[model samples]
Target chain A: MTVIRAALLGFGTVGQGVYEAIKTHQKRLQERLGKKVEIAGVLIRDLRKQRSLPKHILVTDNIEDILAIDDLDIIFEAIVGNEPCYTYLNQAIEKGCHIITANKAMFAQFGTKLLEKAKQHRVQVGFEATTAGGVPIIRTIEQLLQVNKIEKVEAILNGTSNFILSEMRKNKLSFPDALQLAQERGYAEADPTNDIEGIDAFYKLMILSELIYGGQPEWRTVEKQGIRTLTSEKVQLAEQKQKRYKQIASLTKKDGKVLASVKPILVNKAHPLYHVEDVDNAIKLETSLIGTFTLQGPGAGKLPTASAMVEDFIYVLEKDKSIKQQGEVVYS
Target chain B: MTVIRAALLGFGTVGQGVYEAIKTHQKRLQERLGKKVEIAGVLIRDLRKQRSLPKHILVTDNIEDILAIDDLDIIFEAIVGNEPCYTYLNQAIEKGCHIITANKAMFAQFGTKLLEKAKQHRVQVGFEATTAGGVPIIRTIEQLLQVNKIEKVEAILNGTSNFILSEMRKNKLSFPDALQLAQERGYAEADPTNDIEGIDAFYKLMILSELIYGGQPEWRTVEKQGIRTLTSEKVQLAEQKQKRYKQIASLTKKDGKVLASVKPILVNKAHPLYHVEDVDNAIKLETSLIGTFTLQGPGAGKLPTASAMVEDFIYVLEKDKSIKQQGEVVYS
Candidate 1:
């Protein structure tokens, strides 16, 4: 059997999830790719920490060590931040490695550069896990754009913020109380500033805008607001009027100008995002030909995020196989 | 510019919609495929009838005349019924012309055979318009099945039935009255037997079953019921209980067996298909990896359905281009 050697750039929650999914769904992976997928190495911050990683995979604190693996076909990056993640993936691309990433922060800023580099290197880039977790919004937009022109997009993009808002409205709890409850339920992080301040959704919304309109609005021009200021009384008042407060990321194109924003809005029952509660995410797209369409799924999760990466892995490998079969150079 | 010659196999509402879509979206087609798509011929059922078709394109009542068009790269089939439609497409496939069809009755019965023949002749088949009109459920299922095992699918697949049911509940009208109103509103046909008797939904359900589970249950084993027998009193009673009567097509795979059915189901407010009223359609799928995901869109319309066919046409032509670039014989 042909073994497709791959490496993990950051072995955190998402990295562990990918490792576990690849281990468990090996049979399915083989059936799809006609090859065995093997995790050759893992890049971790602390090699001395007690971990549950299986044997036969090299654990290293240095990325160069992991990238040095022979014939590495794919690199699954689940790292955070902008600097090192960007630099590391750029190097991986230089090594002719296909990338499947779940790092939205790094991707939102450097995605275009990385894609250009990948094209020059004749490699593929898969970032389906970067936005909306398990919702195949990226692929959906790609397919829809082939024939239709997307006019507007309204979406619930962040799970942590949505869960907090849902808890606040449903329980009549204050923002602090809802944040505490979300943390207790593992829906929010210890330092939920990024999610609470709407930065996370802003990055995702920018990603969607770039995908649809081929470019995003100026960063400072995008009006970004969070749910921290929403009071329980206001939420109650909205509920009394048959409305719900949701963190909505909106993008609209009018007369060739694209406007993007992320904020909490009061939506009535008729709004599709009105009923989207807790960790669920939904994207409502108004297109030129098909009118209105919406897709809803888990916005963030271990398995769901991992599923997106694996799907991307299968996609990248299939594309590679076709390119190789055709004996042609790939420029994707 | 390279001209891609195409033919229309039927000239009903869907055929006209396809023609208009092609004519209006010519720029988009050229951008996506890098070839100018030109309709060389259209097969109409009547010759002397007053029609507004363009003079340059060939119009004929005979299928042979349209099939005889030289270098016809694609055929769009929107004919009703099962016999001549199936035979016409079969002959087109034998001529190595790609096909995009919106005929659910013909497709649901002979789709597998047609696809097999197309494969033998090195042609592609696009049937995204066959089920759920503009929903794109077929493409969604195809992508999801790459990794996840879809355990169950519950969908509102028929728009006319849903529209009539929505009218009966909201207006407290009788079944016949609501159906008549649907016809008057152009939501239902004058002879609404297929839409009211659940056969339309049944055929679409079987199409989904074939795509997901590889084959559908024996037609006799499937339990099919439409909204024809639904009473206004029952609908009102359900509405009082915060429920709505929806024509749901359900398919479940458990214990290595697949069961399929189409029935008027009472759905609560929490159900994804509950608020999917009027001409809207929604499908909720329970998968092994991504959990529960739902897609909602227009269930039926000239523009929406034509959008799907155009999307398929673009897909077929792109695949053809890639295959030609690959210098290989296509088996699909």
Candidate 2:
């Protein structure tokens, strides 16, 4: 039996979710993994924030304190953007510790470097939560790599955008009103630029493209078209035509060049992704082996994203066990 | 680099496709797996039958000839039904050889026994080809098992039944005419009692149930209904209500009791599986962690099913590598 000492970086929505998952499913995870998972510390912005966690759990604001702890086996990070999370993960990887992150922007921009560094140190960098949360899309892609050639990736990746579009259709509301409702419900961020302008989905698409194709998806080459121009008038017109409008994020590799775009598309009954509603995310992979596979699930929430992290935790544990036994060279 | 020596148990459609995949994608697979794969020999029922294969590959009618080859690491069995195939695979497991199979009925009936025997011998047994063709459904379940308790499964499993049902709807054909079309198109067998009567889907569901619930799904307890009773009139009646007839195989755990069934169901455009037409298969998984996930793909064909088996081959190879390194005990 082994005891895994872990830390939570950026105690926000995703961080709290991870801590709660660890607490709720501790027995089951331990039974399945034959190990005890101990949350060594939590890093948050405010020391006075009274989070509802175990009374004895360590809550710290110092990055130096976490770096000084030599016994840390893994780091679960869900910070908003790239900066400090990337830096913290880099340190953890250099220390030969595993890291799981839900930060899509960090992976999209700097995944190659992080993966290379992790491979060099023989530690896993898991980002299942970075894509369609808790849907197992990343691991499915990993298995598909064993015996398939992927052709196209068409997905509904942004839940906030989808929720707004769904509200516009359901309540006959304007795009602005829908966006306001989404923000009120905490689905959309305060700025709402990333969600409404398709930047969030674009980051997720780049990350997925990096995994599918072994290269970076430069943002400049992608076509960004958000749902800002869409209105209830168009939704009514689409309904008259027996179709619905969906915020679609798609990447197709044609003649060795990737055509990446995020836009709202009209879908009819014939389309498999037509039924994906509200905050659900759906990804359709067209491959040479499987023909076409579509996975639809709840995009992301506190527990779902954290569940994805725990999924990564189990994945890294199993991988580390294998690598330690064989002393085999790691591959990203 | 590692070299995998494998043998074919039946040189039929799936077997021929496996050989063709090995031939067509040899370089690509070698690059991906970092290994060399060689088809050492093939087992056939009749030596008199003419087969179009490369000159140096061995073909023998006797199963004993394969067992005599001591260096064989894995067996790829595609023989129909549960007879000599079961016996041959059992022997291979006893010899500590890994096995990959696409035989659904055999697995549905005797998977637990074979998996138990494999565990006793410290060998891997893979059956990704047993259900959902090349969609990677089984592997996805393996990953989801890390963090979720699966609650329910609803799937469209039988491609031939779906094809016939779709043909009836599209062409206004009678059931007999649709079945004839399916048989002519090679979607259904000459004696397609299994496909039309829903036994094929029943077997697939049993296999999936075993994977999800970790227990044997006794066939007698299952509620089976077929597309045999439905007529074109009923199809048209359902069509008027914007609903399509689908051959759905489902298993739900209600109040801790497992309810299993396969039958024709009416699905409207809002249902995720509504657009899964032709030979496509879709499985919707409801779990405690991820909410709902639906996967749609080409159910099975020669190359697709062969791709699934090759996927299993790769899976078992990686698993065997890990086990050999750790010297760990195997489990079903």
Candidate 3:
């Protein structure tokens, strides 16, 4: 592997983070992977948008500019939503380019479709950033599944909702005031329905369920509630009972069906999820043989999310190396 | 790709667990790896030892009996100590066999040598079972190093010592009484000095340091104090202060040098390591980008330790596939 080229699909916070990480850690990346990682193009909405990058690095307003690159190996999608990004990812998969996506909105809805397309084209997909920002929860679960059956998965999947709940609990703020604080803290967007209404956690839980069971993110099956329904009084009541309110996304088997729910749950001091405060996310995976495995870390941030994508990039490269090793003889 | 053969180096608890898991999950192994797994032999200490294995699987007291077989691809070493077993592992590595061990005594001391030997022989050395049983702590750290620089690692790496401490804290028992109860509960062995004296945790922390900073486990540099120095009064004092006593193995960089230590520390409810109770291990790695990442799970058990070996076996087999894939073109 001499030089592997990649395209950035969106110049959002995570995209800027990816650019910065690649720029700063270029030497370490090359040293670890034994290959040069070249960012061939950055796709954004506006050509007039200013970004401080090297003159050699290309910034394009059109995805076709990146698609025209003859030897492109990866397309790292950081765009939000499902329409254009989904279409772009589908096209990238059809063209046999591996994908590293940060956008869970599109992935949560069209994950099965994208996975099928990738399988058909024999390409790899990396979605570690879609759930928890930098934590290796998904990859860890994949490894655990090789030996143990994961009986239950409980997680704090949305940073915004958790931040809101924590603010409401600590500051004794009303729901509206907590939302304002979250927005002020830059943890919540102006149109924060996706997080406050539990849709974001729902999507993450759906992706988790998809990985565990298969063909999931069935919106109809998931019981959905969010921090919007919780009040300061309710938080105070839970606190009085030696409890804390955390917006939890849980997946458990009930009556032979994998049931998923995104809601605010009261947890006591004994629970691992009890102390996971503010924007930090935690996941507890209960296994048959290994008992309970819990992981807690920074869930969503620019560097953290980009770092997750980098991990995915390395994972895809690793898989590619393995596949190409076989390709040297058997495939050829 | 037809049939890969493995030899179990001990018929103890973990070895038997490995044998049972391999036997039961044969179908899964075949489907996952696209190959058949065959246990060639089990090397035991006694020829008169009775076992329930099939007649086709040979039980031998001599290492040469199993090593003589040319097709042995893997040697899962579940033996206790270094002496003869370490020599046998070295010989096996020299013979171009992959080594998976549950013994940490020699590994902590001779790991660098073994790693260099494995590299020289182009074979892998899998030691997942040596530390933290089945918790994928090592694998997680390996992934974290991909994107972030680890700053500090705080862990409860020993199960037997943790069990004893928890028993003392919960049952209000003395250290000796707790040890007796732990042994009665089968958590500690007859000669539990390795665990009680902090040597076991020291070995685990050393391995972790070696992975991150390199050139480690210089035994003299580590500050070792085990549960032997802990008193029931100290436990009571911690309880009075709403804290718990935990035997923590920590590795951190001070003035650009990695410092390692194993000692009893007091932790409050806010800390992740505080509540990690009986027979459970936890590792909290503080990093530059991802903040604090923690993993907790059942640390030691027959099935759990065996599951770790199984994980190592699969890891070695996966790497072997890649190596064989390349070998098909170059080596042939």
Candidate 4:
């Protein structure tokens, strides 16, 4: 059995979840893949801080320790933001190490460049966890787009916004109350500007657009709207009309041009997005060959997000094996 | 590029869709897989029927055409029902030709035996298109179960039943009217007993159980319920209570025992399945690692079902390559 050596870049919520998942499902993973995956190192901001982790696994604050590891096959980047994650990923790629990341901010800006670089280095870079947590939307779309022409990709991509909206509709709470409830429940961050202002969804939309449509729509080109403008009266009115308010992010290809947007729309009770409440996300794809396909799941959470990262890890391992077996094949 | 030769058994809806999908997406498939997949021959019950097929493609009524073909790498059985499809798949396995099928009935009954035979013969058997059409649920579950312990899998597996329920909820139609409307829309067959009686969902549930949970839930063991018992009064009452009715098929591993059932349940406006109306099917899987993950799509349509067949073909091809590369591995 092949043994894949991996390292975690950030030991945060998702990173810790990945560690737990790997430990909890080690035997199952080994049986399924006919290989053992071992974590060689973990990189965090603080080295002195105590963490719920095995002492046998090396923990370091320096990037050089992870980058310099000769046996490290892949890097799992659960770090937030762009600058340092991008730098670490680039270094990993340069070292001919494959990567799986849940960082959407870096991907939204530098995905193409990273993909190109990985291709140049003959390595894999998977970003399935960067989207809808455990929905498998990225891989599903990759499969569908291989056989079908996708016309429109629509999704309730942001769980925080969706939770806030669902709360507003159900409890008739004002935007402030709903946001506060979300933050208190740990669904929203203390500063939830990226989610509430639609920037998070916008970033996801940009990533999906680039992936499915093959190029990013200029961020400013998207007609940005958020759930913040929704009032309690509007929420109540939607409920009265048997509708639920949802923030929808959509990317459509029309005449070879991609149109992307993020907005709060009142979907009727019959619409699928109307029922996806709380910290759940749903994506609906309209393709030429297969018509419509939708996937829903926990959009953001410790386990679900980490499961996605594990999926990407498995994908990278499989791709690595395939490439090794069939040299000079264009995998991407 | 490696070229894989294949044969198609049956010229039914799914078979024709596979043919057309292959022809339409040949370039993309070749680019992605680094191989050209060609249909070497087609097995049909009657060759005199007026069918639109490429003249270069040979159409024959005899199974010998597929069996005798020396270069055929795989056989795609799109034939419905048990006896003939099973016989042909077994023949393919014996002949050392990998098999792909959209025949759920055969798989539901004899998947273990067939997979054992394939393993013995060093071949592959793919049945992705058999359940949930083109949603790729089987593959997703296979991947997830490899890395996580699945707790439960609940799904609106049959599209016909989901359509009837959705129509009943939306248009306030009686069960009979809704079913008739489904037939009129081509979502249901003339003899819709298998679909409406919950047998279809049962079969899919069995497949899921075997594939993910590693054992088949006895067909009779599952408490089966269908939409025929649903009344418009209940639909009205559900709407009055701000709920919707959905036909749900579920399999759960609880306390080391497998529990499986197909029944109609009342879900409030908050449930994702509530909004999955009009021929749409949704599946929710609760796992130890991924929490709750749901997939919704056109469960049974001409193209969607056909897309699944294509996926099965690709899966077979990839697995065949892998098995050939790896001399022998213990089968779990």
Q: Can you write out model 4's per-residue Cα lDDT over A1-332, one digit (the tens) per residue?
A: 37878899999889999988888778867876787879889999988888877776778999998887767889999998997889999999999999998999889999999999999999999999999887788888887776788888879999999988888877888999999999999888889999998999888888898888889877778898888889999889878888877899988977778888899887875566777878889998888877888788889889888888888887787777766655423231
Report, for every candidate in turn, its global Cα lDDT versus the true structure. Answer: 0.88, 0.86, 0.87, 0.84
Q: Per-residue lDDT tens digits of candidate 2, residues A17-38? A: 8988888889989998888999
Error of 4 at B282 (Å): 1.5
Candidate numbers sorted by DockQ from highest down = 3, 2, 1, 4
Candidate 3 residue runs with Cα over 4 Å from true position: A254-256, B330-332
For model 2, residues B1-332, the per-residue Cα lDDT tens digits are 37778899999889998988887778877886687888888999989999886776678988888877758899999899899789999999987689999999999999989999999998999999999887778888877877888888889999999998888887888999999999999999889999988899999898988888876556798878899888999998888898999999999777767789999999886777777888889898888877888888888988788889888888788888887766542221
When 1 and 3 are scored with lDDT, the better candidate is 1
Relative to the true structure, candidate 1 reaches a TM of 0.96
Q: Using TM-score, give the best candidate's number.
A: 1
lDDT tens digits by residue: candidate 3, B1-332: 48889999999888998998888778878888888999999999988867888898878989999899868899999987778988999999989899999888888878889999998899999988888998888788888888788999999999999988888888889999999998898888899998998999999888888888875846797899988988888998899999998999999887878888999988997788987888899999898777788888888888888888887889888987787777777877
What lDDT tens digits, residue by residue, belong to model 1 across residues B1-332? Answer: 39999999888788898999899889988888778999999998878887787798999999889888989999999888997888999999998899999989888888899989987888999999998787788888888887788999999888899999988988999998998899999988879989888898889888898899988789999998877778999999999999888998999987778899889888887787887878888899998888889999998888889989998898787676666655543432
Q: Model 1, range A97-122, lDDT digits (tens) per residue?
A: 99999999888888889989998988
Model 1, runs deviating above 4 Å: A323-332, B323-332
Interface RMSD of each: 2.3, 2.8, 1.4, 3.3
Per-residue alpha-carbon lDDT of candidate 3 for residues A84-158, written as tens digits (9 for 90 to 100): 999899888888899999888888888878888997888999999999898888899888888777899999988
Assess the local accuracy of residue B42 in candidate 1 as a C-alpha lDDT between 0 and 100.
Answer: 92
Per-candidate RMSD vs. true structure? 2.2, 2.7, 2.0, 3.0
**Superposition error at A97 for model 1 (Å):** 0.5
Q: What TM-score does structure 2 among the candidates reach?
A: 0.95
